[model samples]
Target: MTTSSPPHDLLPLAGDFDPRTRQDWTALVADVLNKRRAEGDRLAPDAAAEALVTALDGGLGTEGLYLREDRPLGVPGAMPFTRGRVVRDGTVPWDVRQLHDDPDAARTRAAVLDDLEHGVTSVWVHVGEDGLAATDLATVLADVHLDLAPVVVSSTTDQPGAARALLDVVGDRPTAGGNLGLDPVGAALRTGTTPDLGPLAELVREAGAHDGWRAVTVDARVLHDAGASEVDALAVAVATGIAYLRHLEAAGIDPVDAFGHVEFRVSATADQFLTAAVLRALRRVWARVGEALGVAETDRGARTHAVTSLRMATREDPFVNVLRGTLATFGASIGDADAITVLPHDTVAGLPERFSRRLARNTQILLAAESNVGRVTDPGGGSWYLESLTDEVAEHVWTRFQEVERAGGVLAALEAGLLREWVDTAVAERDRLVATRQRPITGVSTFPNLADTAAERRPRVALTTTDAAFAPRRDAAAFEALRDRARTLERAAVTVRTIGAQRDFGARQGFVANLLAAGGIATTDDTTATAVLASSRAQYGEHGRAAVEELRAAGAERVLVAGRAAELGDAADLVDGEVFDGMDVAAFLGDLLDRLGAPAEGDPR
Candidate 1:
């Protein structure tokens, strides 16, 4: 059959304009920078033009421009799989794995079957501890078609039991897909135990008898929840995987078979571009490791399952988490993950209801069916930014992996507190970024809806444990703490004393109000309130100072100016403190909450 020519075929796309060179772009950047430059202050042309570049962690960055690729990143389903490890054959590019954690076997079974009937391709069940009982595994899977739909099981401290229960459900099935979810290093990291590789022998051997089930999983979500950077997570995964491989080798498994026995679970967040890049980077780096081990080309690439980050979910205004999940799923699919699980939006709130699970399942479904995001192979493959970013991540992963190895592998790194130090540093930086609202979390720290009622869910069973080597850290935790305490305050309303008209005070007023509401405190214009804030558009030293003094005299115990403390200048002493952008919000809110009055018992947060 012959095809008709498209409209663009008849025209030269950029015909009216000359091709713009980097030099021309640089000149324009320099001109723009000149306006922001002070009088008589000059910058070198190159430096001025390069100021548009952005700095990211792991020495990775984005330039004002990326040169077109001089070298090709190879095709999909091949060695070094930078583009992708596999080219999907259908519209649904990845497995839709739904997580089930309800302790009720009947409840979990119903949700599992419902999800599968809708769109979920696999099930990852939490067993033991606070989740479904390991003994009840059969009850949960009795209705499930084990051969057709894979069932993976994870436990806090009972992998052997979980695996045994899962195996019983499978019976003599010749074809099954899913992992045993075994990670000794991950367990050690979480429980602060010494590394245990003894379980690999029995588990790996038993898993070999099953056609599609893998016994090992390198779950980097442990580090991700602990606030490890993307590079740190990847590096830890590599180190952990290496440690596993060595153990498997000693257990007498062939290198080729050993590689197939393992899979990876990566944490995907709202940063979609970085999420995709990190996955692609994992493939590139792992492929090289396999090559060095003399493993075959096809077995080299890691099997990846992307999970929407647990650490990114907010307890307050959790509806925003739906958007975060969508972005994560998009990134995971475009990066060619073998499977993906998006946590329910209300995950942090409590046990997710059916509504939340349905939304979670349909998230990937709509992305595939409606958006057709899965129609193409490696959707982000050819972009200059993506390719460059992937390379940058792979390089950093290798460097960090080498560092971990030099410190005596993943276990030793954990024992020596090396890994903890790495996570702590990254966490502090993340805390700073989140606290300053530099990386604004919508509906949490930014644009908070104080009047909105909190989403309700069934209370989940809580699990106690030994002191964890790496405790989970959430970006919104600090702000949420403030919000929690603000709710418990005896006097929850603070007077926002605006200076001049709404326009005069609108921006700062809005800013101050939003900031206060995030902590669950209400705002008012009542000058008789104990705490009064001068939100203004007028100059602080000129029009704002008198308003602060008036508020102070009107039974107001404390007065605040909502502008730069520096801008306050001579009027600084007229008010208690300044409320401005880049201020330490947690600190500011914390101090304010303390001044207002403590909760009935103590600080609830």
Candidate 2:
């Protein structure tokens, strides 16, 4: 029978209540009173009386990621289109843009072709020692049908020759399109070289001179990856974009034309919600920039392209990198990016192996074809949570952008080391959290075994740092020591086999619970006939023995332990029926409901 305590017994009333109440009404009253008192004392007393009046007066509200009554971005699709989407018939799903940095020309060409064949539509050719050189450029780009696939070329130097070279192969083709990027500021900041601002501004004009040509204004992702927060990255990007516009305006291009030709490449990290919000906020911030330049909002949304950031990619357990990439890809698509890039999982080390690149491409294919993620237009559009966060972040970015403007634009801010200082603060905070494991990386910080001996092919970049030697240090010694200690505690632990129609079912549940308990086997309630849900702590030595004895008494036999196929000894034996391993949740749930005589035949939701 269901047992619930009396409402009055849950808290104490001002007067007396019956002691025989089953719902703990008295305790409820006490809790309510305590919470009310705590909340009353917690808020600032000075702002209390007039808070509602001020809120009604539009003192506070949402702006992209910030709130207010006055809208700066304008309504969706309307000119100065900052408040919403601009495409007349909804945005085209963001393209699956992958990066290829293989030094081998033929191999890199084949890799790019493979991604295109597999449904990826855009590619970014990395700059520096790892990227294609003018010598290897032709061979690497020879068979590239730009009409079928767009290419984004990035270089460390301000020289647009390589991009120009790549573009020459497809020369002014109507269907051939992409961004020409040479971040002099980013390169100078990275290499401590004097930025050639004049030539760089010239390249913007020269590239935009071609129809369908997008000359990138900022690659602020470098700062974000190097340890800048969303606000810092957005602020720098906005300031940089403004500086570029002014520079172009002085170079004889109208500010409107400058904004149209320039696209801001942003970071789409692991924080899915944040990624979505930041992308939306990016459009708003840029819209505000346009408004400041006296341009309409609708024209602004047409100019942004969001690139998924690879900075959050971890070298450890490279597979987890796939999950992060998928999430980032989805976030970008939902956030309405014109294009998105999914970095290979092993990108942190060096150039990705063919296997990693294939996995990355297939991930997008599965999401678009199988998962149908592409079918939805702006999946996060009108989401309250996303809208609120977007407004908050936009406001934060707006404030910081203003600060940079006050510091005399991006170039001046960087010259004054203001940008660097802000980036340093973000990096320091990330480093601090990572050190304490408060922001732990799964296979990196929790468990690392140097001798695992699994051959891993990683991305190759010329850049190196002393921090790479031991940063994000995993506790190998502690892992082994804990494993050793577990051996002694085995007497209390019980191995459980949870049977389910789907193989991953029990394993996922068991893993979640075991992780929550820190260690020890925890089984799911889904078994053949009976169910078991016990905490890891509850299954200690003597307690485990008693629990097992009780299970034995309850008539359980031939228990199938739920775990990865790698961990399971006899996967075939466990698959006694039509049990699918790692089956889709929708299909699995459909089957489960059908068996319960409440079939889910419509809408699937």
Reference-based lDDT, residue 545, model 2: 43
| Candidate 1 ranges with C-alpha deviation above 4 Å | 1-11, 598-605
lDDT of 2 by residue, 60-98 (tens): 223222222333433556643433354423223556678
TM-score of each: 0.95, 0.65
Question: Which predicted model would earn the best TM-score?
Answer: 1
Once superposed on the true structure, which residue ranges of model 2 sit more than 4 Å away at CA? 1-75, 79-85, 88-92, 172-174, 447-455, 458-461, 464-605
What does candidate 1's lDDT look like per residue over 209-244, in tens digits?
Answer: 888889988889988898988899899999999889
How well does model 2 score by local distance difference test? 0.58
Q: Quick one: RMSD of model 2?
A: 16.6
Against the true structure, candidate 2 reaches a TM-score of 0.65
